[model samples]
Target: MSQLRVLRVVERAHGILSSRDADAPDVAQVNEAHRSLRPEEVSKAVSACDRRDFLSMSACSLATALLAACNSRGPDEAEKVLRFAERQNEVVERWLLRHTAMNHARGRIAGSAFPMYFISKTLPVWDTATRGPWMLDVSGLVDRPMRFTLEDLVRLPARRQRVDHFCVEGWNAVAEWWGVRVSELARVVGVRAEAKYVDFRSFDSNFHESWDLESATHPQTIVAYAKDGKFLPPPYGAPARLHSPIKLGYKNTKYLTNVVFMAKRNGGYWSDQGYEWYGGT
Candidate 1:
């Protein structure tokens, strides 16, 4: 399954909202729609939506009552009500998207902290023997496409730097990384003139991200194999990962397996989920 399968559930919820009478959907109609959803689907709708959606419905009286009821609940219960509302109304979701706050990547020097955070439980891990057969496939919009092994990459001119990492989840960490600069990879691959973006693919759950060609080839962008002067651990993305000081942590995809230069803009995992697409410093 795709790493983004949850997006489908969100999309389905939107479909239900769209099929309703936009001018005003009655509370009974809305209730029927909610009740028709599967238990897991209802959870997805609630978890994925925000409060504004419910308020925008034509049945304002019912929605206002729901809001009042929500206020009397605990924080967790209130949040669930708001999320359910957001998922139930498409207009509300769009409004929330417009109001979201996003920060540009800072590219700052590392501070002392280096806490690690992993997103998915199904992270790909490899030992020296297991990684021996692993190779990074570099293709698309390049003259000299190549597959590079870990040893092959280590032989290239390598760089090390301490960079501040910012997550979309509102956390930051600083760590030292060692890897071959992405610009060198571009040069070695003979990137074509029309290539305007670089798409990175991960080994875990088909997680992927794309960056503008300029950022992709930036000096601070590298395919890192080591962290804090040691081989990267599995929790930190072993074998190799894409690292960039000028992008959000999500944009710096981990367990990187491929790099493809292309002309079109491809939305990333979180970016598709309403995060900033540029995500630049």
Candidate 2:
């Protein structure tokens, strides 16, 4: 029920590999070792894992993503998942998404909730009644712990793009997202000399993702709000979400709670389960 899974990269190279002990890296020095990142692997490893195998495993992972959305107890959990996906997709297509690209947010469900049982919902989320300062605190190994409002963000320059979103679970989708450039955010935060890794957190309990700074400033990366031409849905991390050309589904989180910069990389939620925390794919 945690929506958290772990995957361990046992061995790599030569032939078929299948050992589950992540702690003991046998394969080309595995990335973040844990189960929280189930159905995930290095980019090249993903291709090597075989499409048939990934699809079958992804069926289960997708089910998990769906169940989390449909269940009533989960509340806006579905929206959160969808929002994360949409935002990530947005970042992917920020440059390519145009009026021609249909199904962009702000068109379908205006201030609505995502359906339950949706296989990995990519819905947006919001709360008109309550408004927050909307600050992207870039702390940790950065120069300043900067903060920005929604207007403050939108007012700044924007980036648009279109790209493929490869989920760790073995599936892909394309979408257009719009928001402030992450490259600018990095420039504002000013990464310090020691900064090497970046950690992202969500409002869903303590779900989080960790990635290298190299991916943080990716042009395709941005903190989005408007999808299509409307406010971002709640499940889509209405207030804000981090998007990057790097990392997998687990790395793109919804209902973003915090974005922390650290010198060394910290393990992610799914990483503890056996999944690769680095989530390069």
Candidate 3:
């Protein structure tokens, strides 16, 4: 999507997202960009929506669109962006339904009504040695592969940003994020010309996702270490989670365990649920 379109959706909705501001009241420019955009570009944005419309979206829905866009340019993983919406098509018949937008620690424009998943782990934290794998791997079509534990990540040079959180549902919040520069990791991995996609898998469940290498190494991209002031909560994919600019919430798998480099596009967990595999929102 055009930067103007991306900005207008967030600006007009007052949605939360993480990125540098270009200008104010982007609606006119955004509309012009939308008109000038080639058919393919327009389709790209339209395809991202499952059941999108001016009213089909609540304040929360708009928040999700903007914040998600602000975090990073739509995933460079592929030319396609897809998402699965579990909406039940219950016409809201009312305009003043009180839709509000906010930001998250990752600075995404999002709708808070959807909420996030929080899984509990009651492991033996009491023991100092049984801290699981302790290391996350970033390896693919590169000469250098990385295997860093939580400690290793914290020790590395870090970057921080304040941005809004966007959700597929509706609602948003802004927060600060601190993590390793994604570009640094890309250099460490030695991204090759053959490399095209970077897949992410979480440690929590089998939640997995893929992104184009371009978006992976974008300046806004990061392998975060902390949110706000405290360590990442388990529910928020503690230890490590990708702050991807090119994907939707579902694509941003939490508790990243592995980063696989690939040459073709791959579908995500929710893709089979009637959502597009390239869900960029």
Candidate 4:
């Protein structure tokens, strides 16, 4: 079935489901139309709903039915359905980030035991002896590509935020962070009009993550240099690291080395391996 036709059927289903006087006859007709669509057709219809901003509560009711119909198919089709659902989730998350303010309450600090993680076997640290002094290189799609030393970042206006950090593994911690806001750096470097995404690279086995420009420049997003009133410890991304309550823990790259403003997203360490690209908390 054509995507447009599928959408019409889904919309009809939504209307029937929403009606106070929905009758057996009306529901049966909607069911008949819905059952006639193949899994791919239903997927396309859901994508269409997402594009049209029809994934509201009404559309979700219809989608639940449509997905239920497709669930009988084999595992490959089930995987496709999963991907479609994840995409819809990303759409909702991006919309929320754009429309709402993240909770920045000064919660109790997690302190030394805040779960430490890195791709490397040992904690990734700046090898001052081998790699020389640590420097943050900001380049790509900006008028003034510049590198900043730790001292330079400390000299810039700093913001302190106490926020919760959520991990994909279902653990979370609250910490106090002090750093220069990413938006301030953008202003100083003159980010180009064409740069739609920001890529943060790390020395942690070349781990990196890309973010939409909006999230990258959020007032809460920062290259953190200190935590809980002391200079950042090596295990907690000393020298500098990206930190934001707006994104999941993995999205905030640690052991930072480079920041690239890009015209397109280049997937990050975990995101490239099937973690959601948006990675919103």
Candidate 5:
């Protein structure tokens, strides 16, 4: 079933290629690159069980398209980009509405039944037995810094949304995520008017991500506790994670420990490595 999902994504990519302007250099290059891969090789490439593997496999598949996209420059480029984004958003919204089941995690990453990958060198292991006492601290540039335990989070007003999760490496999956909106948290913490960014600090390797204050407070941005009706699996950032529908997968930091509202940016782990600082979808 998982493999089938990956295959479907490949098929969808092929469809996207067909719909693209054939005369466009980027489209032609992308088409050629995809065509160069044998079926077996394509299958192997999509069999990503973890972060490093996912990036490696998906990069090979998306490079030509990325290059072609980067090469194009024009006066109407900004308008074209906006329209392109709108179309993509509409497709994702429609897909999410059609498939809202809070079960099953499937994706382009083939081998893994659960497609989440830990990109970090070492994984953080929390004592499951001490779950209730775990805390999520919300502080910085707020009138009231607050610390909430898992019990507290569960008790807060929770919302669930089935949204498409896009990886920067160019693969996507849909999952039903349940948690409190970041705005709700911001309210509780009394976010200051001057705050410009919300920095998310994670327990795993002290990993961190920052987002524009508006994006962080967007209704679709949540401090997620569960995916698919269950407590988030460790690989998927169990206990809690920052989930934003508008952002790429890397922006959704796992093992989330603290959210610090600030005036300036605190560059994210991946952003430090040349990934876009604003990883919007």
Candidate 6:
């Protein structure tokens, strides 16, 4: 089946399972969906199921039955079928992602109140007195590992773009961001060709995320210092934070501390907890 069609089937199957009422039609739908998949795709789907435990007992039983009706895998080996579907979704999302700059029209900007999100119990402020002045460290797979004071970042060439911010929880806002483009920083530091991923780390409970190099260096991706024409307040990740229209809110780590380039992907905090790792908008 085509990628899009395959994804639709997976989504249908999930909805059926979640409803907790997999009736006769739902079972037939799942069987028909699997019948459309190529032999290699079927094998891979079954293999992925065999590799990981399911997130819940009920989900496991439901998915196991769904797969058993088609592939005849044992219940235990069918638990991660959903995970396989997720990986396929990621592959399709990555293939479809583009680096073209998003339209940032001034009229699209939202009201002044952009939602603030951080995992720390209290707002995370950079205690310069205790931690010494906050510095952003850029290292790993680069010709010159460097540290930048907030002032140093301000001194770099700046870019301003108004873009929509999407949250995984189903809300979105539009805001203007001003900061040095991460691509500029990569150019200055001389990122090694082998570095295919970028890891963004934050001081807010050590929350972090990794991104493919293509998305990291997109023209609009920035390490933002200002929002809506004002220097960021503590609630909005003062000092500096990663921002991009291409990624979801959680992928843009706030209260920034470190940026590392790596050859392989290291999953993020939310991603490690079962959120989609790619997190594309």
Models, CA RMSD each: 21.8, 24.4, 26.3, 17.1, 23.7, 19.5
The number of residue pairs in model 1 that clash at the backbone is 5
Report clash pairs, candidate 4.
none
- Model 2 accuracy (lDDT, Cα): 0.60
Please report, in order, the local distance difference test score of every candidate based on alpha carbons: 0.74, 0.60, 0.61, 0.86, 0.76, 0.85
Candidate 1 local Cα displacement, residue 171, angstroms: 2.4
True lDDT of residue 86, candidate 4: 90
> Any residue pairs clashing in model 6, and if so which?
none
Model 2: per-residue lDDT, tens digit, 156-269? 888765445556778655555677766687788787878877888765556777776666666666777666566666655667776654556667766665678888878777
Stretches > 4 Å off in candidate 2: 1-132
- TM-score per candidate: 0.59, 0.53, 0.55, 0.72, 0.59, 0.71
Put down candidate 6 lDDT per residue, 61-167, tens digits, no spaces: 98787776665544555559867988999899889877774646444667566788899999999998899999999999999999999899999999998888888
Top lDDT hit: 4
Q: What TM-score would candidate 2 get against the native?
A: 0.53
- List runs of model 6 lying over 4 Å from the truth: 1-79, 101-108
Candidate that beats the other on lDDT, 1 or 6, i.e. the better one: 6
The segments of candidate 4 whose C-alpha lies over 4 angstroms from its true place after superposition are 1-74
TM-score of 6: 0.71
How would you order the candidates by lDDT, starting with the best?
4, 6, 5, 1, 3, 2
Tens-digit lDDT track of model 4 for 164-213? 89888997899999999999999999999999999999999979999999
lDDT, model 4: 0.86
**Tens-digit per-residue lDDT, 1-281, candidate 5:** 35564464466556653556474435565566557656765656466465666788899879765665564553345666766776676455435432122223354322235467666686665665865456899999999999998889999999887777778889777778899999999998899988999999987886798987867877888999988878887888878989876778888888898999999998899978756677775
Query: What is the number of backbone collisions in each predicted candidate, taken in the order shown?
Result: 5, 47, 40, 0, 1, 0
Judge candidate 3 at residue 114 and give its lDDT: 25
The better-scoring model by lDDT among 5 and 6 is 6
| Segments of candidate 1 deviating more than 4 angstroms | 1-119, 127-132
Task: Estimate, for each residue in 215-275, the C-alpha lDDT of model 1 and write its tens digit.
Answer: 7877788999998888888777778999876677889888888999999979888777766
Model 2 residue 206 CA deviation in Å: 0.6
